[model samples]
Target: VTKPYRLRELIARIRAVLRRSGSEPANDVIMSIGEFRIDTIRRSVVRDGVELELSRKEFDLLALFASRLGQVVTRDECLDEIWWGRDLADTRTLDTHVKRLRQKLEADPSNPIHLLTIRGVGFRLDP
Candidate 1:
């Protein structure tokens, strides 16, 4: 619950968890980096005024980053929070999700300027 991402999905996931336990969503506006804006309450990602479709994991991944924009979110923390204590044997899931997020969130996913990998450390989102 301590791992809030800079993505758009975390708010919903966190909100859902919280609601299940009799709580409320922390806030709204998951992402607002450059041309893209993610509204957590609406669960919508708008880029250049057009709404984009995102999977649950993709939304959650982006939301995680949104909560902690500009900060590097560790891989383990991502897996633990997003995957929810699932098996940590494979990290390719995280990589794949990030790649997909870049594709939708970045103007040029090939050379991303927003979502970035911090080499061996983790990933950081540049606003």
Candidate 2:
């Protein structure tokens, strides 16, 4: 019975109903990518026994990529997800965050293997 319904809103409603009905939704709170492990429940990421400290937005950014795995996350999609669909004054924020994330996660930020850029497209996490 949905004519003009957003998928996100519908999913949220479904989850709420399932919780109230004592039927929990099957959501994997933990995810792994190569040596890095993300725990959505604790909001933490650890790689090779070392805990990587990340800001809220940074974690969100990484989580988005992790969820998609080896897919090319488009610039528009990244901006929408990370910035909450708000148009920012400066669009370099995403690039800055990606740089910081590479520095923290990759062995070499200059030649990043994991967080590789897709040129005119966007970025792909080679997990």
Candidate 3:
């Protein structure tokens, strides 16, 4: 049982929920920038017509970066989104993941052109 709810409020809430549920189909989400293409519904990433095999977290991390291309995403934001707000003593984990991601994403991991470091800031994905 719930507390009393106004008819208008209840109807609005139901409509909002329904709208979010299937207003837009998942298959419609095909994000692309330059040679990179990500089919979120299919959970696949393709660069230059070549598919890149990635771990679950790796894919998620890349997707996050891809969503905000050319913008530096802060460490705290990454930690919060990926690690669910877990406070890490250091960014070693994030660094490692980024390194691995760069390996798959960049032509030269050592001298990366796409995934770049901001030096004390965070990371940016340049398409």
> Number of the top candidate by lDDT?
2
Stretches of model 1 off by over 4 angstroms after superposition: 1-31
lDDT of 2 by residue, 76-97 (tens): 6777676645556687898899
Q: Cα deviation in Å at residue 69, candidate 2?
A: 0.5
Per-residue lDDT of 94 in model 1: 90
How would you order the candidates by TM-score, starting with the best?
Answer: 2, 3, 1
TM-score of each: 0.76, 0.77, 0.76
TM-score of 3: 0.76
- Candidate number with the higher TM-score (1 or 2): 2
Please name the candidate that would achieve the greatest TM-score relative to the true structure. Answer: 2
| RMSD list, candidates in order | 7.4, 6.1, 8.1
- Which scores higher on lDDT, 2 or 3? 2
lDDT of 1 by residue, 76-95 (tens): 76886788645657789899
- Please, what are the lDDT tens digits per residue for candidate 3 over residues 1-127? 1457555445545554564476665544788877889887778999989999988878878877876789998886677666655557787999999999999988889999989999888999988
